[model samples]
Target: MKTILKNHRRKVTVYLGRRDFVDNSSTTEPIDGVVSITYRFGREEDEVMGINFSKEMQLVCREIPLKRDVKVTEMQERLLTKLGASAYPFSIDIPDNAPCSVQLFSDHSVKQ
Candidate 1:
């Protein structure tokens, strides 16, 4: 899901269905089901001493929907792959200390 971008700011919302499951991040078993995610980006921070913090920030994605057909950053992938338990929502806090970029794969693979 692509968050709508307004001007240079990203302020979009989405929803994922809820489900019941168990912890299996320790195994390779496919947690085959739906996941949820909600991402909110803060306004660009002012540059500091010729260093722009806006370009270097962390993103926290919560209630993000997951799918095997959806491939994300290695970190995100690892998180999803290692998620031990399932609940009403899937949340992830990404420390994107840089320009954040996210792409949702329809076929479940990261675009190369």
Candidate 2:
């Protein structure tokens, strides 16, 4: 298990973009967007083969901007990549107890 101090900062990139579903035209421009890190998981309670116990569950969720307020000029947007997106760098330190993303078929019935 890797250990991280409380003061350690985790770095991440924030991508900004826009999509128009009406015309099937989509554009993405990396602008300043709010980034947040969260820990998501639940306990698995089950009884199997006369055994009753709970297991640790950890899940990874995709990063989505919770809030956005950046505005870019037309020229800046045009200068963006063909996807019309720019990437902003950010960092956040997570708790040491945070579970790392690991794929384990603890429950054989579910394939993640």
Q: Over the full model, what C-alpha lDDT does candidate 1 score relative to the true structure?
A: 0.34
Per-residue CA lDDT of model 1 for 20-80, tens digit only, reads: 2233444322222223233456655533324222222334434444335554544434444
Please report the candidate that would top lDDT against the real structure: 1
**Per-model lDDT:** 0.34, 0.32
Tens-place lDDT per residue, model 2, 80-103, is 322233332222333344443333
Model 2 TM-score on a 0 to 1 scale: 0.20
Q: State residue 79's C-alpha deviation in candidate 1, in Å.
A: 1.3
lDDT of 2 at 111: 46
The weakest ten consecutive residues by lDDT in model 1 span: 1-10
Give the TM-score comparing model 1 with the true structure, all chains together.
Answer: 0.19
